[model samples]
Target chain A: MKFVDIITTAIANSFRSKLRTGLTVIAIFIGAFTLTITSGIGTGVTSYINSQVSAIGAADVLTVSKAGDATATADDGPAPYDPDKATAISLGNGSRPGSTIQALTDADLGTIEATSGIVGVDPAVQVTPDYIEYDDSGKFELTVNAAATLTTADLAAGEQLDNESTTDQILLPTTYLDTLGFSTPESAIGETVTIGIADFAGTQQQVPATVVGVQNETILGAGAGLNQPLTDRLHAVELSGTPAGAPQSYATATARFDLDASDAEITAIKADLADQGYAAQTVADQIGSFETVINVIIGVLNAFAVIALIAAGFGIINTLLMSVQERTREIGLMKAMGMNGGRVYALFSTEAVFIGFLGSALGALVAVGVGSLVSNILATTVFENLPGLQVVQFAPSSIAIIIGVVMLIAFLAGTLPARAAARQNPIDALRYE
Target chain B: MTVPVLSAQNIGKSYGSGANRFDALKGVSVDIRAGESIAIVGKSGSGKSTLMHLLALLDDPDSGALLVEGTDAKKLKGKEVNRLRNQDFGFVFQQFFLTANASVLDNVVLPLKIAGVGPKERRARGMKALEQLELADKAKNKAMNLSGGQKQRAVIARALVNNPKVIFADEPTGNLDTTTGAVVEDILFSLNRDKGITLIIVTHDIDLAARCDRQIFIRDGLEDVTRSPEAIEKPAGAHA
Candidate 1:
């Protein structure tokens, strides 16, 4: 018989016992649905993390701090503090309480910039702006970060803060737009605003800067971003009355290295810096723990999906074996009519594969439909703060792979019953009551 | 004068072994020519069905040669045997063995499908076979809805679809009423006479055996050679 005919006939026969076939299909559907949903969640989360990592800073930039003493441990009693190294700083996300690295100073920044493979070093200067105000609008408290100069903003409107511009520029957060008397992000672009800050003498000083852009809220948190020129003005105003003999200290420093450097090259740079009592971490290092947690969660979910699929595989075997038993006389008749053993085997195997196709196709369609709906609802309610996260996203290639894998499992399970049917004695089967 | 269409030479077949060994057919030989209607008559367990299976190439003989045309049946490959059966032999069983869920037309076209005939061609041939059996109007009906007589006729339609050189009927009329049985018997004989298609019937009914051109009486796994020639020479339609 023709191969096409065998497949078409097998597909028709699968629906002969509607209840039995539908139950088996539902079993497979459970596995496929879980697999597709978990896979989408994994894709959605990892892609969002990746975008956040890129937003933090350029890949080549490394956060550098003073390394702890070689022999110091948490169990050790507090030691006498030296004046030059008493300052402390905290690394964000996944850091333990009381985990602080000694702060860097101007002398340390110069040393890092002069080191081999180090191109640029920008000190992490702290700036506190009391409030910002537009024409006739009341002042609103605003948080400004000088580190924003080393980072890129996820913009909602206008361009990114221009680090190279000699003129003072600021990237405003979307939350402050309405309070600043701007109706929209686009309307605030290129408009000037006054930032009030108290100097060391307790006198308030007002600095005027033009808005460069407006940025959307991200998972990392959103704040006003000050470019190098605007940050220098704020720093100068905040330290006007401080003593001249006091040493300048910083929370941390951003150092740039070769963009195309190999892992070994970067590691070697870290080792050199360690010898000079400094420590360095890349963006991936700061975000690596988060990725690990997400991966572990996804792996556990996938394990459950695999278990469900294996159980469904046994369901396919049971269903086909029963079908073979019920159709013994029909099998004998076909064999007697010149259908060969191989064709008989093909017919049953095709039936099993058809069942897999039905369940997986239905499951994937419903998953994409429901998953998108859930993501949409969550985006506006629970995940409202995260603007660009889809929460669940489907990749076409992964969906295809899931379907192919389920079909393969069905084929393996079918081999036993198909072989039994193929090897049946025509005379005996014909005599079967 | 012409070569016999099927020849069996000292064929033997047995079932079981050791304590339960039973020889279904010890030594049976017969020759059937093209266009001849022959019956092998016996009681149940007399090996008439076993001998028919050997001649039909469905089972292998333990000893001696069974030949189709001129080639020994044992010499043909498995696929060749299947092809020969598909193209050259048709079967009608007392059980009717139709897929009840399938339409009557689908049941009738089974042999043509196994032969890999195109859909349009098989449909036309299948419909023609049904028309010949006077079942053209029931082609769309489910096989389960057919009466015993109509079911037997549908089986005949399936048998005729492939236009085989021979038709094997094993108790074809055993499940039908007397009137319908007569009608089925007439159709088998007329096909042998008009189309020159050979007929091999296995039946225990004496009246049906007498309708054939010749009868081979099998008793105790062997042919009864002592049967009188006059019994074998009885004319068709001589019995009710």
Candidate 2:
């Protein structure tokens, strides 16, 4: 018979019992729906991670830290202190026990900068601000973390940190505005605040600074940026407070590499740093860990979808087998009318593919609709801090792959029944009551 | 002088295997010439239907050959046999065997569709066949909605829709009432006479068998062709 005729007949035969076929289609629908949603979730989160990586920092800049020599990895554990090895320097609240380390000195900084592919290196200057006050709202002590080369920040109000200025400009966190007695974030920007620290001989000293911006604190970036000259001024005051002959070192250094450097070149640079007893990592490398975690989660979700689909495949086989049994005489009639075995097989297989198409198309459409709604709600409410993020996103190629895989499964499932119909004996079938 | 449209030579067929086996036909032979109207009459289980099936190439005999339009049907592959069935022969059954859920027109259009006839031409030819069978007005009705005679006519239309060289009817009027059976017989005879197409029928009705141009009787897996063409086994109504 003609292909079109076979297809029409298959479709007609499939729906002969509407309820049975509809139920089978629904079984397939559940599988397709689950698969589409899970795939969309994978796409959305991976896309979110990509965006976050871009916003995190410049691609070529690597964070450089001195290599430790077999120190205790435990956070609360203690080990024998080696004055010779580099350690993380933690200066804490007064009278509180804090760890000090052999920081990267001028010599070590020069070594990192002189490494091949290293364009420049800047040592992170530690700042220990004693107190801050706005006009006579009593002085409150505060601590500071060294700023990353953060050019752009998600701001509540005001411009970004003035990295271009040598003058002492600061960006204060939202929590600080309340402590400094500022009425609003907008009002605090461009306002001058005084930072008081002890000068050389345990004497009270004060430095006036302009607040250039006010920003919401983020987990990745917990502190404020200080211009080069302000960093120097703070260090100068800190040095003056200490007695002469005190050793000076740094906690970490930031190194900028060639913008167009190849992966091998970057690897070579990292190797050189390692040889010099230092470690370096680029932004992509840092994000790689995060990607691995996300991928594991998506993988698990997709596995569930696969299991659901396999279960649905059994539904197809059952439905087609029942159809073949019910239509035994009709099958014989068609064969007697001259439908070849191949044509008989095609008819039944086409019915299966049609069922798959119904389920997959319905599932995909419903997924896109529902996934978009869920993503919007999440972006607005739960993931507000990470803006421009969709919690569920669909990719066309992934959608196509899902449909193709399901159809292939359906085809396999239909094989036994289609073969049964194809291999039916015409005389016996006609005689079948 | 008319050529034989189809012939069977020592055809043999059976069901089951070994001790449980039962032979339906054994060395049965028959010839159906073009434009001839005939009947193979026998009691139930007498292998009349088996002989017709072999003649139509619906089933192959284990030990004998079948020829259609002078082509050795035994030599044809399965695909070629199917093609031969669609293009050269048609069938009607005692049960009518109309798809209960399908419309009359769709039923009539089936063989043509299997023949791979295009939709327009298939429909036109199917309608023409239905009109010839006096079923045009009922074409849109479902097969189950029709009376026994109407259903048989729809089946006949289907058999003729492809304009086959030979039409095989296995008890075509067996289910209808006396008047309806007579009407179906009239249509079958006129089609054979006017269209010059070959007709081979299998039936237990001696009266119906007497109406054909030639009569045949099969007994115990073999055909008994009497010299006289007036009766199948004995003259009609002689036993009655």
Tens-digit per-residue lDDT, A1-433, candidate 2: 8999989998898888889889888888888898999999999988866654456667788888777655557784888766654445653323137654447777788889898889999887777778888988898875664543344565778876666677687778777887788889999988888888776676767888888887665445555556566667877887785766665678777899989999999999998898888878887787888788888988898888888888888999999999999888888988998988899999999998888877888888899899999899988899876566788999999999888888888889889899999999887898898
Off by over 4 Å in 1: A50-57, A66-87, A92-99, A105-115, A145-147, A200-203, A244-248, A270-279, A284-289, B226-240
lDDT tens digits, residue span B133-180, model 2: 989999899899999989999998998888887889999988999999
How well does candidate 1 reproduce the true complex, by DockQ?
0.67
- Docking class for model 2 is medium
What fraction of the reference structure's interface contacts does model 1 contain? 0.58
Estimate candidate 2's alpha-carbon lDDT, on a 0 to 1 scale.
0.82
lDDT digits (tens) for residues A1-433 of candidate 1: 8887888889989999889999999999999999999999999999988776676667898888888877677788777777666477765323487686777778899899988989899887778889999995799888775457756778889988887899899998888888889999999999999999999898999999999899887666457989888888899999999988777777678889999999998898888888898988887777887789999999999999989989999999999999999999889888888889999999999999999888888888898999999998998999987888889999999999999999999888889999989988777787788
Predicted complexes: DockQ each:
0.67, 0.73
List residue ranges in candidate 2 displaced over 4 A: A66-81, A88-120, A125-219, A222-240, A248-251, A268-279, B225-240
Q: Tell how far residue B64 is off in model 2, in angstroms.
A: 2.0
In candidate 1, the residue pairs with backbone N, CA or C atoms under 3 Å apart (3 or more residues apart, or in different chains) clash, namely: none
